[model samples]
Target: MKKAEEVRRLERDRIKNNIVVTSTDAKGKSHEDIIHAEQIGTKIITSELENTAGKERVMKNKHKQLQERIFINNKLTWEEREKRKKMKQRMEEEKKKGRTANMGYQKITIDGKQWK
Candidate 1:
């Protein structure tokens, strides 16, 4: 049991240290894509931005904007996807029960106090 727990702990730690890389073109717009390194959890970026060529201010602005768009799009998509799935499931269940009321969802709240 101890060995198994150790393995799970290692796996969790590995996931936490993960890093991502995104490269952009000369215009500061994303060139190809924001690539992600998998299990290695580390990224080595190889791009023109390495030298930060061309106008410093313009390049920086473009890079920042591109990164912001990618970050917001990726974050919201992943985070909200699960909630969307739950909503769909609830709607389906309500349909099956022939209920038309708009219902709020309750996550299984386990109160420590037991019913006597």
Candidate 2:
């Protein structure tokens, strides 16, 4: 209970403070949240992989440097932005195909079965 409270508090602090990166371990998974926090200049704390051997790679200094870069500028260069736009189009097409292929997947109707 205390740990959960701490995690929530950290998350709230990061958002409220408008930090670039904040590390946290609310889900006990890979320290992906740290990447987010770091990107936004927030420092998060996670005990998931500190003592593990394989995590040494994830804990590398290069990752920290990248976070610093993100903190400086969240935007990509013109070329990179163009590449991202193309990537987004590709992803949208894939999502459309997936939805068309799956019969069980229903489009969300927020009002339930109400016949609009």
Which candidate's TM-score is highest?
1
**Candidate 2 residue-wise lDDT, 17-53, digit = tens:** 2222233422223344233322222333323322324
- TM-score each candidate: 0.25, 0.24
Quality of model 2 by C-alpha lDDT: 0.36
Off by over 4 Å in 1: 19-116
What CA root-mean-square deviation does each model show from the true structure? 12.3, 17.0
**Candidate 1 residue-wise lDDT, 1-116, digit = tens:** 99977876776444332223343322223543323322222322322222223224333445565644422111123323576567667666766777653433323212232211
Judged by whole-model lDDT over C-alpha atoms, candidate 1 comes out at 0.38
Residue 108's lDDT in candidate 1: 20
